[model samples]
Target: MTPTRKRRLVAISMILFAVGVATTLTVFALQQNMTYLYTPSEILAGKVPADARFRIGGMVKDKSIERGQSLTVAFVVTDGDGDMRVEYEGILPDLFREKQSVIATGSMQGDRFVATEVLAKHDENYIPRDVAEAMGKAHQKHNVPEDAAKPSTY
Candidate 1:
């Protein structure tokens, strides 16, 4: 083959290889960041896989919060249909309060959710779309009080 043709073929091959690598790396990064999502009702219904890292979101149960030693805090997360106990060890956000929307990412430890990271809504009526949708479904299924499933402005 001609020298110019050989050079063009080699360049094209290199470009294809680079694209393949970039695609692979992108997929790997996404896979690592992916976490299973569940609501309290789903977890109570045995939908959550044991020991699998996942995210659970719902309203923080009223009158079910307790602070322990250091930064450890225990609370109940409820989707109106059910409640799950969550244990977190970290600095909670100022907006974190009872009846507020929250999402906790962690693994299931026996009957409790051992959270690695906890996120709370900054204001009323500002819940994440996923959390709201999940809670809506659970509330509809169980006929839970709309006020209980909602993030209170109070």
Candidate 2:
């Protein structure tokens, strides 16, 4: 109706539009870069996205490790109730071993987890906080073996 009122309305509208655009762009960027964590049980239940880059934390199943040419190694990451196979092409950590808690970062292919990086627990009786919590929950939910349920210092 009035010239001053019209100018003020236009200014407010432009400010709100800029704020909306900035918020949308920020959310899109974060979505693209986010890497989530998962457990073997979640993978088995088909809760994990197949194409998204994510991290898996669990114990290295006993007698489930295999060595291939060079530094390539394959192992089973288990969360008591379920097991997911992991393939890594780099040197494993010195602490890596069967029955140890580990976190692998990668994507899933078919039923196998193709890991780009693997991290094993550092100290005896000490599992990474997040890995320990997830494994403990999984162990509680299923009738997993006591040894498997316990996070060993692998």
Candidate 3:
């Protein structure tokens, strides 16, 4: 082949290789930095990596909250089958109450979740948008109102 043609082909191949490398690196970085949400039972079943940052969602067990003189609060999060204690030192959401759904984010330290943040469900009928949408579809399949059976507002 001519030298000029060979050189052009090599340059094109190099550019394609560079693009592939950049794309792969971007994907790897995103995966490494992504966080996932799991339920309390999922955590108890060892579905989560021990040291990776993730979230756990469940109902805050009734009367499980222990408030200290300071801002520290300890509570048990349960997903029916299992429970995990979480410790946090920040003001909880206004809707945070006993027996309410909550999502805690952090890492597992031993058997406990040292939560860096806690998100409480807003109201009785208020599931997280994602959860609500999923449940809505499920309810539609079963011929039920998505919000009809929700706990009464009082």
Q: What is the C-alpha lDDT of each candidate?
A: 0.92, 0.91, 0.81
- Model 2 stretches with alpha carbons more than 4 Å out: 1-5, 144-154
Candidate 1 is scored at a TM of 0.83
Q: Write the per-residue lDDT of candidate 2 for residues 1-154, one digit (tens) a residue.
A: 9999999999999999999999999999999988887889988888886588999999999999999999999999988788999999998999999999999999998879999999999877888988878777777777667788688895
Which digits, one per residue and each the tens of the lDDT, describe model 3 over residues 20-83? 9999999999998887877666677688876999877777899899997789999998766568
For each of the candidates, give the backbone clash count: 0, 1, 0
Q: Mind giving the per-residue lDDT tens digits that candidate 1 earns over 1-154?
A: 9999999999999999999999999999998888977899999989876768999999999999999999999999998889999999999988899999999999998899999999999799798889989988877887867689899885
Worst 10 residues of 3 by lDDT: 130-139
Q: Highest lDDT, which number?
A: 1
Backbone clashes in model 1, listed as residue pairs: none
- Order of candidate numbers by lDDT, starting with the best: 1, 2, 3
